[model samples]
Target: MPTSRPNILWISTHDINPHLGCYTGIWPGAEQASTPRLDALAADGLLFEQAFAAAPVCGPSRSAIITGCFPPAIGTMHMRTRATPPPEVRLLPEYFRAAGYWTGNTAFTDFQVDVPEPMYDELGDHTHWRLRDDPEQPFFMAFHSLITHESQIYLSDEEFAARTPDAQRVQKADVPPYHPDTEVYRTSWRRYLELISQMDHWVGTILDQLEEDGLADNTIVVFWSDHGLGMPRGKRWATELGFREPLIVRWPERIAPGSTYAEPVALMDLAPTMLAMCGLDVPGHMHGEVILGPDGRVQGRSEYVVSARDRMGEAEDTSRSIRDRRFRYTRHLHPDRSPMGHTEYPDNLWTWKELRRLFAQEAQQQLAFGEPPSILTDLQRSIVAASKRAPEELYDVRNDPHEEHNLAGLPGYADVQERLDSALDTWLAEVGDLGTRPERDLLARWRPDGRRPRAAEPEVDNRDGLVALTGTTDGSTIGWTTDPPTADRRRWQLYTAPFTPSAPIWVKTWRLGHEPSADVPIAAPAR
Candidate 1:
């Protein structure tokens, strides 16, 4: 008999904010990239209106979702792999592997955790899953699509021609107020839509393959983007457009059709949810919760979904946001950092790489009204660079869903600001956030590769026979014995992490660490 354990299929797209027809009204039935397959998935599953990414960018958010913890909490706060993981910190697939599930990650695993650690089976990109070593075992697989990625590489001449008319007709450009509006901008936008269309086709192919395998019914299929649309709102900051992502969970036997959840949910919550759906206990170290029903619909949104930022030196930002049906309140610990302080230049149009020089030329020295005389000053430049934002900005989402108005210092909206401020303060206190006050030096201390000792010889503990090596920085990568040393020079498995105050990392197993024969069990310290 076929087992009842739910097979998990998590599909993630890169740099896609909530621009789908069902999530944002701007693209509904529009000639611009239509997402019919995605829309159908939403209809069949529970659609989340306020689902947020763990971080604004991919590397951080991916690390958080995979581990079911915040990036900073796990020393993966930076955008890439920086440290060797502690042996005991389990991967999502590792937990499922314990439950007798065959785990395969086809597309992406940017978490940077040490490989050869025995968590998931990497099946590269073959599309055909039935041919695997174990066919009927329930599984967990993540497919990350690069089709909607920010690049001119995905755009073709035909697509460029198809969007040229709309490109020329954008009357005001409504260009995020932070970016430069140039012909280059319009061209990039035009090509971006083309890329989105391409993404839709790629998504359809994945769905078709799932059906072809005849495993669609029993599988719990979840489709979501890592973050927002690849525009100004895509890469950095904590604006509604940046963190909010499209989330669709489909399970025919579990979720009710055509259901929508308006409550806010963070990507951090996904890890715990997956674990719960599989009837496993969420680890005590995880910070997220499981809110989805067995049928793949949300029972309710989180009371509050908080996002924090600690970019590398460019800007040290910390923000706490709380959103209900009516209000979205954000308290910035370092309001000065705003989006303008970062070099990511998310404001550049989607395929801006094609016209990078042209956009740079047009954007030179352009300043906003009442900007400082010396616009080069860091503070002044930030303000001028992001003219749309204020030190304290508030928006009544009920009236202005696009967040175009600034009600922070306004006469009538003072009450709203006060109320929102109170909410932010309470949340900060609860989360142990010190506040938005800028601490530039503290930020410097948290830099990914700031200062660290070079890896020395592995020091074997004479008492326990286990070799211990320390990391130089938060995300530093180091290799060590898979288990306690026995006789000779065994190969090493890479591990990364920052020290956890609660439990120190300790090794429990050993293996012949040499290449190819790198199969071994390394028990990490229990969190």
Candidate 2:
């Protein structure tokens, strides 16, 4: 009998917002001439206007999407922090694999750890999809594109000038009010749109390939971004522009063409929705609800979406936000710290540098004139305020869509703030958010002694010029290094089979989520 399951293809992009032609009606000039392919995709698929990521940064947001749980709840909220989930906590792909689906992912896992062995039959570049053993078997695959990453904004001014001609450039008036209205800013926006156009072409190729392979009707195609645009006060902020994403889903078998869903949804919901569509049971541990099923209609209305911001690189801050239909409320745990506090990564961006340079120029002009030196635009003041956050922020998104005006302390909005605050509290409690605690406090909670859970010392056996290493932990893997244990140096080699030894070696053992065992030296065997 033919299988009833449909194939799944997830195409993810980096640091892009809902700037497509479909969303252009809402965000004017977002639709550049270069995005014909994406415009076509939106015309053919269901466009979700209110989809958001659980966190602003890539690693944490991806963790939430993959695991279907809030990153803070799983101790994976910090940027670049890799935490292996306990064996009991299965990932989204693992669930599908267990349900007899062939799963694969491109080289971009982006979760900051090894993809569990059971999660995918193949895990590599885009070509891995063609390497699946059985083409007829239902498959789930993810392909990630990096064309619109923040680093793309680093193009030289000459390059920007040469690449985007006047006719192709977005007008300076179209630049967001929060950003400076300068040639450099407009050039950056044009460059980003060009990259988006390039990304759309690649997406069209993949979709075309599916049709050529006769799998278009049997495949469910999803395209979205990890988070939002790679701009200052965008990528790392806990604002609408930071968390909102462009989500489009095309299932030829179920969904109607050109449908739009405005109810709030999140990247985390993708896992459960896919499972439900595949006729599998949703796991109890997942925090997201299924937003769509086999019927291809909106499953239910989601009233609110929660997002977070935490440590990024050397900078440290904590913020939580809740967005209901018309209002957005944010609470900053460390209101005293600057929102732009010394984050090296974002500081290097041309957008950010230009913003700072403009601010400095204005300040210097004021100082030269011997005035009070307080001549600053609302945008400039807002940027300054970002450095030092208010304890609470409430915005009527319908009226102040850019979130410029804070109404948390206003008289008439007390009830709105209180209601959202209560909802945020309930969510924090339910998710067990460790973001409320300091970094040291979180570390102490995870490990009472402030030390990692180390694996037991390995036993080394050497006989007849052969070396064999054994680990005491039941599921631990043995690794070896030729050098002694040092704070900065340790190259571990996974021990798979017995091998003849040429020199002395240090052996250790480790299991995921546990500290590696102390190094044990193994001497060379005598001839």
TM values, all candidates? 0.71, 0.83
Q: lDDT (CA) for every model shown? A: 0.58, 0.77
TM-score of 1: 0.71
> What is the Å distance of residue 492 in model 2 from its true position?
20
lDDT of 1 by residue, 339-427 (tens): 54545443343433433443333355344343334323332234334333455656676676655565678889788778777776675
Once fitted onto the true fold, the runs of candidate 2 whose alpha carbons sit more than 4 angstroms away are 1-3, 84-87, 157-173, 366-368, 372-376, 444-527
Shift of residue 270 alpha carbon in model 1, Å: 1.1
| Predictions: Cα RMSD each | 8.8, 7.1
Kindly list the per-residue Cα lDDT of model 2 for residues 73-131, writing each as its tens digit.
77778887666454345567766776677778887887744443335767778444577
Inter-residue clash pairs, candidate 2: 338-387, 339-387
Per model, how many backbone clashes are there? Answer: 24, 2
